[model samples]
Target: MGNRLDRDQVVGTALELLNDVGLEGLTLRRIGKELDVQAPALYWHFKNKQDLLDAMATEMLRRMNALQEREQEAEGGSGTGTWQETLAGSHRTLRRVLLAYRDGAKVYSGTRFTDTSYAIPMERFLAPLVRDGFTPGEAARAFYTVYCFTIGYVIEEQSAADDPGRGVKGIDVAERAERLAEFPLAAAAGAELFGDADAGFEAGVAAIVAGIAATRERGRKVN
Candidate 1:
């Protein structure tokens, strides 16, 4: 018989297993085995795998949102130097964290939690946008767009964890170029556009924020 596994211990062990084997490889039985306990023991803490995943996601976001909130507080909730800088910082942090572990983005995007842990980051990240005259709804939408793009980009960027040479494999640069030659604009910019993840994220966030600012300015004129 093994000693009792506390809530934190359970979550920590589960997270360890998740990182080692990914979301698809994680299971209650495996976690219990790792802790030298029966599967039923885990059930006592988490109702099911979904419950465990929700808790894990909450835990991960809690740490991220905390740092963001502190930065927000330091910057006065609304007056950060550059909203786009803040967005880039937050999303870059998120991207790095998700890419550090296996299937991290999938786990994060798949779960739903009501805990304000998730919203605190958004509130902080959106502060600059709101201060810049974007309506609350616009800020929210813009935030969502940046977040979705970051997650999607990371997932696609790291999906080939099982392959070491994934990047070079099947990459027929010449063929791809020839195929896209019909579209002059895409062909010209395709390589440059997809080359840098960080650059793409910054550009995307900048464009979104610019659009929001424009919308706000337009609305102000109308009003």
Candidate 2:
């Protein structure tokens, strides 16, 4: 009498509900209601909330991978760029996807993907570094550095934008100014320091990529 509910369908609906209710409000019952399915049906697909969240996180990564593919296709499929550009592009794409959903970084941070499907995307990110003369361990570390930075950046960015008081140390502009008054340079630069989140993210990522490249170059010369 009704369309069959599947794992993909469930996860898709959960992501939709995530945007509406945020991670804190996202629950199986809410997703089931969104799908017009009974709790038992949802249970058949996911044993618990964590299972469903993992699926959602996996789906988020899938979407990020799809976006990168589209970007490469638009750029004539070669994906030609320096290692820094490639890594920055991937990190930026992740930030975009995480910001698309409400509390997406929070959801993704909590998930542990056990699916083999994640391997392809993981390799897509890591392979470039390895090919650029990074050891496998170095490539993994580099990728993790960028990945962790993006996640942490988005979590703070979203929190600051959504709930100002919930952000880092709850320091508002006035409070920051007050706290830094004793330090002239810090007081003068407080606004600039906290002024543009996007600029800060870009600057930080660029610095990290450049640092990694410089380190690798030094290693090559030393060897």
lDDT of each: 0.73, 0.80
Q: Candidate 1 local accuracy as lDDT?
A: 0.73
TM-score of each: 0.77, 0.86
lDDT of 2 by residue, 87-199 (tens): 89889989999989988889899688858777877777777777777888988888889989999988877775456443432346567878878898888775555656668
C-alpha RMSD values across all candidates: 4.1, 3.0
Error of 2 at 74 (Å): 1.2
- What's model 1's lDDT at 82? 70
Best by lDDT: 2
lDDT of 1 by residue, 51-107 (tens): 988888787787676666676688686536577777668887788777667787887
The parts of candidate 1 lying over 4 Å away from their true place are: 1-5, 66-79, 164-194, 221-223
What lDDT does candidate 1 reach at residue 56?
A: 80
Steric clashes per prediction: 0, 0
